[model samples]
Target: MLILECPYCGVAADETELSPGGEAHLVRQGPGSSDQELESYLFGRKNPKGVHFERWRHSYGCGKWFHAARCTMTLEVFATYSAQTPVPPKNVINAIKAKRPDWEGWT
Candidate 1:
């Protein structure tokens, strides 16, 4: 069972208690953006085979959204952090690096 700790409420929520919000740190394209840019924003997303960062809403708990760093293949969770940031926290990145030495760093 996939579980994630809510950074806001500190609840160790199971997947049932949370809602997956797809990939995180997406740069939203707005008005005046090129068609390709808009299309990318709407369709392009990272589907990594290893470590992945994603958004989650603690719907059954605090009802807040947060980010999580986890392994896609093994389902191993590294860390969770606030969604307000534009990128994953350094500690989270380091944790991932610790687990996956050849991760090639976050893109």
Candidate 2:
């Protein structure tokens, strides 16, 4: 069991209370896109190995979407924030590695 800190709720929650909401903060395309483009956009996901920005829903609490910086290999969570947070997804990983390289390991 892991405790997830919710930025909005200001409390740590059990992992069971959350649902994996897939990739987070996907860049939106401009209008006038073709079918193939829309299909590719909807299907694409960042299935990376190291740190990744993932969407998670607090099913048992506020029921709002939140962003989490997680490790795909170790399944460790470094930080969590509300959907409205302005931080870029890619920057989260880079910032973590910059602060604590040992925690992430040889980035």
How many clashes in each structure?
A: 0, 0
Q: Which digits, one per residue and each the tens of the lDDT, describe model 2 over residues 11-81?
A: 68788998888887775555798777777678977688877777788889988778888777777787787
Whole-model alpha-carbon lDDT for candidate 2: 0.74
* lDDT, residue 84, model 1: 96
C-alpha lDDT score of every prediction, in listed order: 0.94, 0.74
Worst 10-residue lDDT window, candidate 1: 87-96
Error of 2 at 45 (Å): 1.1
Q: Please give me the total number of clashing residue pairs in predicted model 2.
A: 0
TM-scores of the models, in the order given: 0.97, 0.74
